[model samples]
Target: MKTVLVTGANGFIGRNLVATLSRREDVEVMRIDSKNSLEELAEYALKADFIYHLAGVNRPENTEEFITGNLGYTQYLINILSSNQKKTPILLSSSIQAEQDNPYGSSKRAAEEAVFAYGHNVGVNTFVYRLPNVFGKWSKPNYNSVIATWCHNISREIPIQVNNPDAEVTLVYIDDVIETFIGSMDDPDASYISDYHDISRSFKVKLKDIEACLVSFKSSRHTLVISDLKNDFERFLYSTYLSYLPENDFGYDLEMKHDNRGWLAEFIKTEHSGQVFISRTKPGITRGNHWHHTKVEKFLVIEGEAVVKFRQIEGEETLEYPVNGLSLRVIDIPPGYTHSITNIGTTDVITLFWANELFNPEKPDTYYLEV
Candidate 1:
């Protein structure tokens, strides 16, 4: 079994990494945080087979604390391992800011240098990741990532500011970072670079575009319209946005249309994939005595029994498909065919329907006819 040591275990990336490592039966994890003593850190350093040094300060009150938190702690760990003649592989989570000349950047750069020097002098393997803005579930809102802050505030109906809408920021999803880190453990040599390694998958987006996507997410509940998730950046951003929703606000009421036959409600609507809706029909009730010119649909009876009847617009022959909740089946309603569904059972019949196109009032391709 591999014994892995992780510092800053309570922070965002640290928490996610630790959780992933803990799920493996063959790997043992040793976590050290602010609450742990220096002696504990030294002990873990001595016994660790691999170390993930993720502890660093970016928002310290004083400039001096940056060195103490980022460089000092890293140097201390290296010293402990060096004095004991241990050559454990270490992975340091550095930032893109390390390229700048700011206090935080300087401190992070120093820490990276220290780790590289230790690796060369002591013959230890080192992996340093100069990561971009990382955003995901456990990230702290308003602390570091603007995406996290916007997700939190927008989900709660609070206004967010976009100081420079044209300003662009590069981002890497937390999951990708974790996957890369775990991959390093499995193959340390492959993760090495001359100066520092980088997460392979990253996105560069404008502030205005991000705000627009986030705003659309908040409005989706009422419109029943889902954003295009095929785009990798939007998909990851949407997932991050949902992770900040208030616990009690996870569910929103859907608009249901009531009639003598039963009630129907739209579930999801998409531009490319069309729409999906659910409906219930009372016993002896029939729905959809109509035929479409170009639109197609699929009917699924989830509860009770029903008979779906279809007749070609140009023919006299009628086709029938009997379906029930016990034997779930999908009956495709083809174009140019009049179709109707009758709830033959005693109880109400529940069915799900999917269409190829969104219903348009101006040019409703539907024509009423008897099946």
Candidate 2:
């Protein structure tokens, strides 16, 4: 079995990395967190086939801790590995700030030098990743990532401060980073010696655009409108935004149009495709005695019993299909066909509806007809 050692196993990226590695059948993981002793770290480092040195201090009280945590800890790890005469491949998660001259950057630069020097002296493989702003679930709010802060505040209805709306940020999702890191472990061709690597898939988004996208995600519940999920950036951001929602707020009530007949609520709507909605029909009630020119629809009875009747606009014969919650079946209402559904059972019927186009009151394609 391949033994992998991960430092800072309790941090955001470290937690995610450990969870991912735990699922592998052929890998054994050694997690070393801040509470672990140096003896424990050394022991794990000696036995590890690969070392992921993710431990670092980004928000320390003093500048000395940056050196101690980032630089000193790396030197300590190298000492342990060198003493054991083990040439294990080491992967270091560095930051984009290393190019700057700040204290954090200076310490990171020193750590990078240590890793590169150790690889040179011991003739081992080492990889360093200069990562951008990494954001995703499990990220701590009010820390290094603006995305995390925005998501946390917005989910709680708290106000967020944006100093520079025009400023753009380069963001790499944690999942993408983890995926690339794991792939590097498996694919030797993807890694090189003493060179800085970057996550292949990253997005550059403006601050204002990020806020707008997140706000749209929040408003989607009442509007029943789904953003264009086909775009990769929006899709990832939307997923990340949803992860920050409060646990108690998992379920939201949809606006239902009520009438003496029954009630209908739109569930989800897309820009190009139609919309999905659900409705309840009173017992012995018939609805949708209409035909469409271009729009088509689908009906599926989720609860109770319903008989769906359809007839071609030019034909006199009516077709009927009985559906219920037991054996869920869907009936398609084609264009140029007059269709209607009647609740035949003793109880109210629950049906799911899908249309090919969003209902436009101005140009309603529907015409009154009898089926």
RMSD of each: 1.2, 1.8
lDDT on C-alpha atoms for all candidate structures: 0.94, 0.91
Question: Which one is best on lDDT?
Answer: 1
Q: What does candidate 1's lDDT look like per residue over 1-371, in tens digits?
A: 99999999999999999999999998999999999999999999999999999998999999999999999999999999999999888999999999999999999999999999999888767899999999999899989899999999999999998989999999999999999999888983553433588787999999999999999899999998888687989999999999999999999999999999999999998888889999999999999999999999999999999999999998899999999999999999999999999999999999999998888899899999999
What is candidate 2's local distance difference test score? 0.91
Which candidate leads in TM-score?
A: 1
The pairs that clash in candidate 2 are none
204-268 in candidate 2: lDDT tens per residue? 99999999988888888878887877778888888888989999998999889999779999999
Whole-model lDDT, candidate 1?
A: 0.94
Off by over 4 Å in 2: 188-191
